[model samples]
Target: MNAKKKDPIKSLGIYCHVPFCVKKCAYCDFCSFSGQNSQTIADYFKALQQEIRSFALARFNSDVGDLAFPVVDTIYFGGGTPSSVSPEYIQKTMAVINEVFTVSEAAEKTIEINPGTLSASKAESYKAAGFNRVSVGLQVWQDELLKMLGRVHQQSDFIQCMEILRSVGFNNISVDVMYGLPGQKLEDLTATLAELMAFSPTHLSCYSLILEAGTPMTNLVKAGRLVLPSEDLEREMHWTIDRFLKAHGYSHYEISSYCRPGYESRHNLKYWEMVPYLGFGLGASGFYNGVRSVNTSDLKEYGRLIAAGKSPAKYEPPMSEGELMSEWMFLGLRKLNGIDDADFKKQFNRSFFAIYQEAIDSLLKAELLVQDGSVLRLTPKGQDFENQVSLAFF
Candidate 1:
């Protein structure tokens, strides 16, 4: 077999999606289900394993024959509540990954868990399987709000889950919280943050509630049965949380993420830095060798393709250079430290100012952007209107 040369510049991140949930949230449009049969979940795992094996064999054989797979630096098990499934399944999947990929000794492995599904046994399994990070979806600390969001777990469940994780020796924990719900007040958000601070999680993902099309929450709002917080109020909520978290010693590294110093989400940082990653499972997406691809969302179709030794990719498009540059600025600006002009030049071999001078000048004039030394970052005003700033690059 002819060996395919390894690309020294390429670093790999792996994302495995688990699409089974005990109950789907009202506002969630992600590919996940409620009350799926055990047999279906089992079959999906089988198909997922097959897909993983097939992908490894094909990538290893294609032009890079017999070469070891790239060293994976990060592995993320994201969900429909990864903890909803049996821990044994997670163990088996990890074993398959270990067999095929050279996972780094210092790799950051994370799994997203819903408080309702986590148990001491599950936490032990995760620890034994080499998972170092656990991200719990606690969307809101208020029990009433949790019920309104159709979450299966209450505030007590969240606390217990945290206890179990800590008991099993998982130090790196992240909590997912949301603001700007239908009846959520600024005081509600403030109280939630206070409670979260008490827990002292390593990381926090604070997201503003978005009314996606066709979601139950949107439907209720459209029917005049629910009232979402006004845009101004939502903006206020964002700044409030930002101020609170920063004052408490959390770095607002990304627009919607805060972390204790040295605890930023490594896997998520890869996306913002435009590092290559492979995603597996139904409806998962990946960016590999400059091509972006998404897997089939239809479970039956995905299973059939894997069984036939065919790629499950529903879309795989090579990004144009202009598109890539646009992405570079958009994603980089998401970080508080923002884009380094030197790094941009190194990646694209083009002067950043030459390409974006007009946009930069206009934004700087509007006080929406600021440049310090070699770094250009979003101003406080710019962070508020991030969507507008991102569009300027496009």
Candidate 2:
């Protein structure tokens, strides 16, 4: 019999950040800009293309010496709002990426969209440009809440956007929702979920509101103009989402992510599983070759540096074995199915139980973690207190 053919190369994920939005949300702290003229937007994409071309495989091969070139298996266009710009920019950027990288034919390509920013023309353009997935930012169903969050789009915009996307033959859709917002009630969350479920989105990301320092929303809470939900109420909201989506045939595969079976975000899984990936654009973070890289947040600096043939990123020293193991445990535990001891041993050449026995014993005794043969997973209660459980492993 002929020997089984070996796979040619390992896979890598690509994240292209488009840091432009129509307007800034009150709660957002991501590295994004608004109110830019056409010139600025055009300049940014030019710089972005330069940044993409800068990572040509020849250059990467010289840096890594003998490291095998990775085939790009996933590409994610995330942003302040990727859809706010002209579809031609997206198309051209995709063209540049294809020129520089060895992207797989069946790669999962995704783009983030703001509801109001998308149109029928843009939706069809995205389909022609080869985007297989769309993640829409629809934090809540109530117009009042959207206004409070400084979101430009309302429920109607979301509905229209979904229709346009479907009309363009795009079916792999993910809707982002938020819970535990200031003045948000349990009933409000359920109502939002109910309205969104009508769209039958293949993936759903339910996030809790986190007050970032210096953001407008945080200032309101600090000044007593708004109040976040109490801890008990927030916990109830989390569980409510869990029960509601699971009943609707969505799998709660990761913390804050639910998907119809087999529809999990492949790009996101790369982060949790510690697979290699490259991040292009301002303030993007990437990990590969055991090193973590973060691009400069300053747009002008990023453009200038790339123009000068220098990287605008800060590279961290490669992670030690202990650090990698800790990250593996924490990130892996974010999944509902948790981590595998056998997989850990295979990666590190050490037994997971032997290393984390004390921490594991304490958590298991407290009923926060359960060991099912070689697999360890968070209990329902443990999921609620994920931070505390993670601290034990650290």
Quick one: RMSD of model 2?
Answer: 3.7
Task: List clashing residue pairs in candidate 2.
Answer: none
- Top candidate by lDDT: 2
TM-score of each prediction: 0.96, 0.96
lDDT of 2 by residue, 1-394 (tens): 1111223387899999999999999999999999988998898899898888767543443555335556889999999899999999999999888776778999999999999899999998888889999999999999999999999999999999999999989999999999999999999999999998899999999999999999999999999999999999999999999999999999999989999999999999999999989899999999988899999999889989988988878999999998899889988999999999999988998888899999999989988999999988999989988998889877
Give the Cα lDDT of each candidate.
Answer: 0.89, 0.90
**Cα shift from native, residue 299, model 1 (Å):** 1.2
TM-score of 1: 0.96
Give me the runs in candidate 2 sitting further than 4 Å from their true place.
1-8, 61-67
Model 1 stretches astray by more than 4 angstroms: 1-9, 62-68
Q: How many backbone clashes does candidate 1 have?
A: 2
TM-score of 2: 0.96
